[model samples]
Target: MESELKIVTFNIGKDKFGLDIMKVDAVIEYEEATTLPNTSDYFEGIINYRNEEVLPIINLRKKFRMPDFDDKTLAKVIVLKMDERKVGIMVDDVKNVRSINQDLIDEKPKIGGIRQADFISGIARLEDGMLIVLDIDKLITKEEKIAIDEVVTD
Candidate 1:
């Protein structure tokens, strides 16, 4: 039997990327984060969600070494629960959820100058366009994950 993978797609600048839908907890509006000191540039600090949970937010653009968007542009955050820790990824916009057959996804090619390529698990070829399928677990370094855990736990 052929397996199908559901992915949540989003835009960062003109490029399109996708994450396994199972990893996504919720999509929320972009909110200003409380900046923390001595953290990586990509770490956008933490935000309190509904006064219940504090999630460490990351700027994908900074992480991927992409150019920043205009301040006037509205953004959104994709919340992900990695084990006991919850992290938020800030994106330009949330595109939509899509389901693609596993066979359609191609292995990630060796590419230069794309910082986030290491985190990419595969590339899915869609009728409209190509989607870079990301492995959320590999998105951050071990040290970064530890920092996020500490931030959320505190």
Candidate 2:
């Protein structure tokens, strides 16, 4: 039987990216994050969700080394659960959820010398264009995870 992979699509710069729907917890409107000091450039800081939980938000554009948005009014945050940790990834905009057949997904491409390529899990060949599938867990390094832990604990 052919299985389908459901993904939440979002725009970062001119490219479209996808996250496995299973990892996604919520798609919320972008809210200003409280900037933290002494963190990586991509670490946008933490936000309190409904006064119940605090999530560290990472600016995907900066993390991918893409150009920054002149205005961030249209930005959206994708809340994801990686294991027991919940983090938010900020994107230009949220696209839509799509279910693509597993057969349509190609192996992660061999992009030479691109650091960002390491985080790509695969590429889904949709009728419109290719969607970069991201391995959310691999997106953050061990050190970054420790930093995020510290951010959440402090």
Candidate 3:
């Protein structure tokens, strides 16, 4: 049987990336995060969503070592669920959900010496351009996860 994988596509600067749709909880508008102390630069602090849940926001631009957008009000947040934990990823914009055939995805290229490249699962070739597929679980390091867990509990 041919497998079809669905992904939520988002933009970070000029590059387009995709994450497993199953991991996505929701896509929300940008909200200012309360800065946290002792966290990584990529950590955009925490934000309360719908006045209920507090989610740690990760700035994709910072995480990817890209410059921040001049105007953040236009940005979007993609809420993702990894295991039992939830984290929100801030991006330039939320594109659309796409379904790609397994055959269309090629193995991620070996970028020698770039350890961060490991998070890239595959590259999906589309009519317009290639979409970089990221392994969401691998995006956050163990240390970051521990810090987030600690922050959420506190």
Model 3 residue-pair collision total: 0
The TM-score values for the models, in the order shown, are: 0.92, 0.95, 0.96
Q: What stretches of model 3 exceed 4 Å from their correct place?
A: none
Give one digit per residue, the lDDT tens place, for model 3 in 1-154.
Answer: 7589989999998899999999999999998899998889999999987787889999989988999878888999999998778899999998999889989899998778777777799999999999999999889878889999898879
lDDT of 2 at 43: 93
Write the residue-wise lDDT of candidate 2 on 76-154 in tens digits: 9999988778899989988899999989899897777775577788999999999999988898877889999997898
Give lDDT tens digits, candidate 1, residues 18-109: 99999999999988889988888888889898798888999998888887657613889999978777789999999999888999999998
**Total clashes for model 2:** 0
Going through the candidates in the order shown, the clash numbers are 0, 0, 0
Residue 57's lDDT within candidate 2 is 94
In model 1, how large is the Cα lDDT of residue 114? 68
Evaluated with TM-score, which candidate comes out highest? Answer: 3
Deviation from native of the Cα of residue 9 in model 2, angstroms = 0.8
Worst 10 residues of 3 by lDDT: 110-119
